[model samples]
Target: MYDYAVIGGGIVGLAAAIAVGKRYPTARIVVLEKEQTWASHQTGNNSGVIHSGIYYKPGSYKAQFCREGNRSMVEFCQQHNIAHEVCGKVIVATEQHELPILENLYQRGLANGLKVNQLSAQQVKEIEPHVQCLAGLRVPSTGIVDYKQVCQKYVEIFQAQAGELRLNTQVQKITSRSDYTVLETNNGTFETRFVINCAGLHSDRIARLTKANPEAKIVPFRGEYYELKPEKRYLVNSLIYPVPNPAFPFLGVHFTRMIDGTVHAGPNAVLSFKREGYHKTDFNLRDLTEVMTYSGFWKLAAKHASEGLQEMVRSYSKTAFVRSLQRLIPEVTEADVIPTHAGVRAQALRPDGQLVDDFLLVSSQNALHVCNAPSPAATSSLEIGKAIASKIPEQSLLASSDCCLVTTNS
Candidate 1:
């Protein structure tokens, strides 16, 4: 029997295991991943942007963790000799109506204690020659990195500390007993004193298996992207984002110059028929029926029907997607970009039809469930892991006091 059994081998799960091993050296920890490889889902298919704490509400978990996580992530990258860039990004206002929203963002950034500066159209041009904007907020702390590589390093350090990893291991059911939690998986049965559920896409399902009621349901929204043609990459200097529409949960289509020197644009959010569906044609009947019958999904759909329709249009029409991109960079055309891989976001929605905008953690007798961790999660993995580790019950730690103590160098 192990002391702790972590579900999912994504970045968050790996980070949690690493943090647990650090805090309790004697505890036996194991991470179970359904996929044969780590980060094969959200962690691997992300835009790989290291977000600054500018967009989140001040004093919120997103803001605090993002602020601290940015520092820790950069430090961790440097310590491991990983390739990363602290290149800044710009949130621009191309239309007159967007100016006020841009100003509000600047004020929010300031309130969050970031070194943000506003730039005029000419100043914006100076930074991004091909971009046209009436005003912009330059966020110097925003950066980019290969999160997959980072997750790999996390696994390496975690395994070096004696943490066991079981890939291609799907948890079929979970039962909590008086003393321990029993997990029945496709591979076999395992017993552990405690369980941490970080099973991103199917987190709610996992929680239900443990006999806990997750207040929110997981709704999968696919974000499709496009990469600029090699010769057209010069049109984007770094990252260029539009003034976010408050009515929408998405950040809208943006241009990002990746660490590999390729420029990626888009990520228009559309409802996915399958939880793991990466292509438009991919569909799952069970996943479809769940969302169709959910009251929260219908309520949310009714509220944002127009925006949702527009997203669907963009998903099918390259011209419409290019037009959206033209708002930030006027020179981008449909011919200049090619469709790339899409990522599915496991967004948590409440019964009242509201999206869970913050980091959500639900705890039971001897288990904790991370029901919602979207967007900046990849950037906030380390701090989120530390936070989850700190919440593990004291009794669990005391129970493993007699095991062999082995502190990790990481």
Candidate 2:
């Protein structure tokens, strides 16, 4: 029997396992991943930007974790000889009405203790020659890296510390007993003294399997993207973002230069029919029924019906998507970009229709559930893992009487 069993082999789960192994060197730990490979979901399909904690509310968990995670992530990458860039990004205001919102963002960045400065239109042009903005906030700490590579390094170090990993092991049920928690999976049954649920897309489902009500439902929203043609990549310098609408959770369409020197733009958000749907044609009946019937989903839809319709339009029409991108860089045309892979965000929505804006963790006697983690999660994986590990009771690791049955694979 293992001392700790972490569900999900994504970056967060791997980081948590590493933290637990460090804290309790002698404890037996195992990471369970349903997929055949690690980080095949959200962790692998992100924009790969190392967030600078400029957008999160001050003194919030996201702000604190992201700020620290940025430093630690860079350190970890350097220590492991990983390829990463500490390039900065700009949040621009092209329209007159967006100027105030840009100033508000600058103030928020200052309150969060970020190294941010407001730039004039000429200064913005100096940084990004092809970009046009009335005003901009330059965040010097924002960077980019390949998170999948980082997750791989986390797994390497975790296994080197004697932690176990079981891929393609889908947990069918979770039963909490007096002394241990038993997990029935497709591969076999396993028992552990403690369980940490870091399942990203199906986090709510996993929580329910453990007999806990997370009080929020996972609503999958797909973000579609387009890559600039090789010759047109020069239009974007590093990263250029719009003044995000405070009322919305998404950071509208933005341009980002990847580590591989490719420029990606236009990720318009739309309601995804499948939890892991990467294409517009992909659909899951069960996933569709769950969201369509949920009262919270309807409430959220009614509130942002206009914005949602616009996102849908951008999703189907390349011309509309290009028009949205033209707000920051007026030179981008529909033919200059090509459709790329899309990513589905597992957003947690409350019964009252409020999105869980901060990191949400729910705990019981012997288990911890990561209910909502998205966006900067890839950037804040290590800090988030440390936070989750700190919450696990110390007594659970050293208790001898808690030993339970272990099922060996045949």
Candidate 3:
């Protein structure tokens, strides 16, 4: 029997396990992953950008965790001798009409407590010679690092502390008793005093299995990308982002220079027919049926139909995607980029059609579920884990409710 069992070996789960071990040094802990390796899904398939918390709302969980996580992540990397660079990013407005939007984003960055440098046309040109912009905001804390490496480092630390890891073990069901919880997995059965569900793609389903009333349902949005040709990579020096459309959940297409020195563009967001689908044709009837039947899905679709259509168009037409990129870098052409790997985002949507923008954590007496951990999650994984571990009542001497009451009074 283990004191704690964390589901999912992704960055979030590994971070959670690490935190538990640190907080309770002698506690027996196990991390369960259904895949053969850690970060086999979302964590492995991402444009590795260490976000600076410039885009999140001020005082929100996202802003708090990301800002702190940026610091902690860099420190961890430095301590581990990981290769990373604090190469700043720029959000540019290429057209005259986009200038005000760029200014607004600068204000938001300031509100989020980020160091924002508003740049003129000449300053933007100096940073990225090939790019054209009416205005821009320089976010110096943004950088890039391989998240897969970070996850591996977590595993090494966890194992060094004698924590256990179980891979290729799909969790089938979870049954809770008054004293402990029995988790049924394809590999075997395990009983633990506490369970933390960090299953990224299947988090909602796992919560439902444990009888937690999660506020939103996970809807997979596939972000498709293209890699710039080797010689044509000069379009971006670091990361060039677009002024986000407030109505849409996704940040528009832009340029990102990966840690490997290759540049990638696009990532048009479309309704993925299947949860794990990487291609436009890949579909699963079961997944499709679930999403189609859910009332919240329809509400979400109806609310963003126009933007969804445009995303679909860009997904199919390389030229259309190039046009979106051309807004930032005028020289990019369809031939400059080639199709690349795609990752599905596990977006949580409320019944009222509002996208859950921040981290969503649901807790019960015996279990804690992370239902929504979107962008910047990788950057904030360590901090997020520490935060979650702090919430585990058994680790604290004072009663959970009493502590909360005191917190409120204080």
TM-scores of all candidate predictions against the true structure: 0.96, 0.96, 0.96
lDDT of 2 by residue, 110-203 (tens): 9999999889999999999988889898999999999999999999999899999999999999988877999999999999999888999999
lDDT of 1: 0.90
Clash tally for model 2: 0
Give the residue spans of candidate 1 off by over 4 A. Answer: 396-410
Q: Write the per-residue lDDT of candidate 1 for residues 71-99, one digit (tens) a residue.
A: 89999999999899999999999889999
Q: For residues 68-126, what per-residue lDDT tens digits would candidate 3 score against the true structure? A: 99999999999999888999999988777777778788888888888999998899899
For candidate 3, the per-residue lDDT at 13 reads 94
The Cα error of candidate 1 at residue 90, in Å, is 0.2
Ranking by lDDT: 1, 2, 3
What Cα-based lDDT does every candidate model obtain? 0.90, 0.89, 0.87
Clashing pairs in 3: none
